[model samples]
Target: MKKSVNKTITIRDIALSCQVSPSTVSNILSGKRQVNSAAGKKVLAYAEKIGYQKIHQQRFKKAIHLILFRKHKLILCDTPVFSALVTALDNCCKAQGYALSLSYIDALTLGEKATQKTISQIISDPTTPILLLATEMSEQDFHLFENAKAPIMVIGNLLPKVPFNIIDTDNFEAGRIAVQHLIDKGHTHIGIISSSVPFDSAKKRKQGALYALQEHDFPIKAEDILYLSPFAEETSDNMTQVIQNRKEQFPTAFFAINDYLALGAMHALIQHGFSIPKDISLIGMDNMPFDCLVSPKLSTIEAPIEETARQAVLRLIALTQETEQYIMKSYMGVKLVERDSVLDLNTCK
Candidate 1:
């Protein structure tokens, strides 16, 4: 251990020795950054060895607790798209000198009766802000936020007329963009593969699809729209049947709510002896990493994941700092990425 008569061992000194920025060293010392786990560990060990002073006490209390709704915790953690959003949120928090912690509440395991305890545990620190996320959480469940002492901001679900702050993509607009692309390509026969569950995002996207069809004066047929359970194992076969039943009348293009559903639809289309973009063009939402790796390279609506994450953190900070009285709901824009999966009918002709 380096014995030091000096009590003022600066953050820059530690940063220089560690070959990282002073902000990074500070973030590591204050438990704000964890994305680069190895770097934090190395910095910690080095600091301890050099007898670094405890400077974290002088830092501002910028802790943020991220809680996933019990109903969709597994999906948020396990899925690549949702997991990437969570990671982006984490890194954003760290970059701004805010400590971010993930709080897990298992509603399935503990049952609905234990909700009070869950809320109590989540708001244990009154000063720390809370960021809640869920794929399909209801307003009734969101009422739990009223009891939390910390300022709250929700991600993904934006309840209409609610006072709570929200940061999410314009899913309805994204849906419109996806369908309009097919329409612009001269595809009159368009299909939508939607989730069986009544998720707001999926519902909004479907509505957007309907609006696009109406705007373009295209006939909306009931047989062209298909609903399948996102979690079901038999989706591949069901998707096949949904198209096979239509047979020669099947839509020449499809819009899926997400990449997972798009991949499923792709597999089913291929199984039914259909060539992608040759027989049918497919597009999905959420530009997940796997979208590039798949055959034909998925055409998708790319949500501003990193920007949304940064905005959420900044809004939370503004609210906590009293710079903003009410944090308004914000929607980030999305763009369609044209790829091999979508075909231009004019060119094909």
Candidate 2:
């Protein structure tokens, strides 16, 4: 019986047989450049003669990359949510022994070419895995994932239309519950500080709040809603516009989309000398870093950030292991964390 050797052929073998440099052989095989017809023929003949085959690329490095879609460079400082997210993801990765890397995407950074250079490197490597901690993922971002073999998990509270795996908090439920909490406290007319995510992202959350209101039969007037900037710092002028335009039209109790909105709205209220909880009860989500440090601790919805991070790492590992183990949707539940910011209007009178 003849022995069948199981071995991958080398570019060196083809180069030597064709009397060409290894780099020329590599360029030909990688399809980076076209060789002359005569040279091409020589290489192809050599390949046929030796039954040359490409070596199977090795993987199994067991590291994951977390890519953040930072449309603005100031996402970290502007939205402290990233701080919590990074902390949670880092601790989780450490526990699981997986590596994490971050890259921000912006017009200036990826202007002429949306090729996320850092991400391109990772994708080019066959072994590494990827998770995207993204907000406002664009057409270009989708292009990056077209043929990617690595499992992609997008971390956010909103549901995007992308087909990649998503691990997120239930912002819609968060919205509904935040408003409902105010209603339970006997505030009939509740207002909201809406978020400024992209249209596709923000629609469902706002709809969820309305669904809760209608479900509970709470009358929510449209004028009471306030949306703040997602990309920029809080400005007094914007808050002033909301108050001037919407003061008497809405409820005293407010459900701000996230904690940052609550803080910015609080600053506007303070500037106008409005008493917290005495005149207006406020609720925000995400229990941001400033929540504890502020004068009146914000009554807010607390998402399980640390736990979300821990689970994301595990999910990535599993996806890498079993093809069927891939996860498409994961939502972290949220709870209300009450503080001094909200007042029972019943007690006020």
Candidate 3:
């Protein structure tokens, strides 16, 4: 017996089998030109039956450029969240017949003249679709890309006023859910550990936590909210100082804006001889891998990072294919991941 090689299926072969012109087959397959309904249906059915592979034309394929706009070194770094998002976007692009490219704009060190030049160079290519990773960007920083001619979408941040397609995690809802969980656990007195850097996501999470507290008729104290440095070490130091100053009074539970801050707070609590969930319950957002690896583990809100990236890529591709461009704002939902960090006061009783 001899081994046989499978033959490649082509549009020409499909057209010959269907007894139609190659141009008619090509037009029917691509949907660029209209063909007779009966002929189109027959050609499509035969093509499917024979397993005809439709190759995307090189000229029609577009590149998606992901611009990682880093205004500071705090939020957007070499972390698992960032890595997962990038990987998801790459996978989506490959599946959608588009090439993906990455660029970094570090405004922290880039001078004004150089930054403007870089922005100009990026926006110069009108053919390529752009997806901005604007996690650390401010409204002032977004003005740089406002005038671009390319089809642009923003990821990881929400700019309500700026008209562009956006895909971001629902930070506000995540914060509310975290606080509500603590409240349901009979924690009326709760504290929020927020970033001092004033990222939009952090601000929204803080607002949502505050809103949840207020809705529960809980008294909001000025000292209960603590703003720590974005760096984990600095956050730990600041938390330790806060703990020392308020030795007599501490909230039964604390909600950190992100896992980084939560871990830092956990270290400070442990150092100060406070037991997790026994003396103080805690929760955080952005369910990083370290959440599970920690001693008591961390209860957190899982940001839909992979889903956000996938949706952003799909939407960006859609925008590129559209004749009339329209702005779309999409908010991906977050999930509450229950772990060992939270203690239920209701069960204790």
Candidate topping lDDT: 3
Per-residue CA lDDT of model 1 for 1-349, tens digit only, reads 9786855555556767887655456556655456467767788998888765344333435678877675743245456566567667867886788756666556666677786687777776788898887556777777666777778888887878656889888989999999999999989989899987677789889999889989988987887788876763656777877776775578899999888788888988898789998989999998888888989999999988888889988888777878446659878899989899998998877
Using alpha carbons, what is the TM-score of model 3? 0.82
Cα error, residue 233 of model 2, in Å, equals 3.7
**Root-mean-square deviation (CA) per prediction:** 7.2, 15.4, 13.2
Full-model lDDT for every candidate:
0.78, 0.67, 0.83
Per-residue lDDT, model 3, residue 123, is 89
In candidate 3, the residue pairs with backbone N, CA or C atoms under 3 Å apart (3 or more residues apart, or in different chains) clash, namely none
Count backbone overlaps in model 3.
0
Candidate 2 Cα outliers beyond 4 Å, as residue runs: 1-62, 72-78, 116-120, 138-140, 157-161, 196-202, 245-250, 325-327
Candidate 3 stretches with Cα past 4 Å from truth are 1-61
In candidate 3, how many Å is residue 57 off? 14
Model 2 agreement with the true structure over 1-349: per-residue lDDT tens digits: 9999965455555766787655455445534346567887688667757654222122112456666665545333424566557656755664576544544445456664565564566567667677676655554556666566676666763444567667777878888888888877888887777765554335555676788788878777767777777443654457767777764644778887767778788878888778887778888888887798987889998888888887778777777778565447877888989899988765656
When summed lDDT is taken over every stretch of 10 residues in candidate 2, the lowest stretch is 53-62
What does candidate 3's lDDT look like per residue over 106-151, in tens digits?
7878877788889988888888889898989887778888878788
| Top TM-score model | 3
The CA-based lDDT of model 2 is what?
A: 0.67
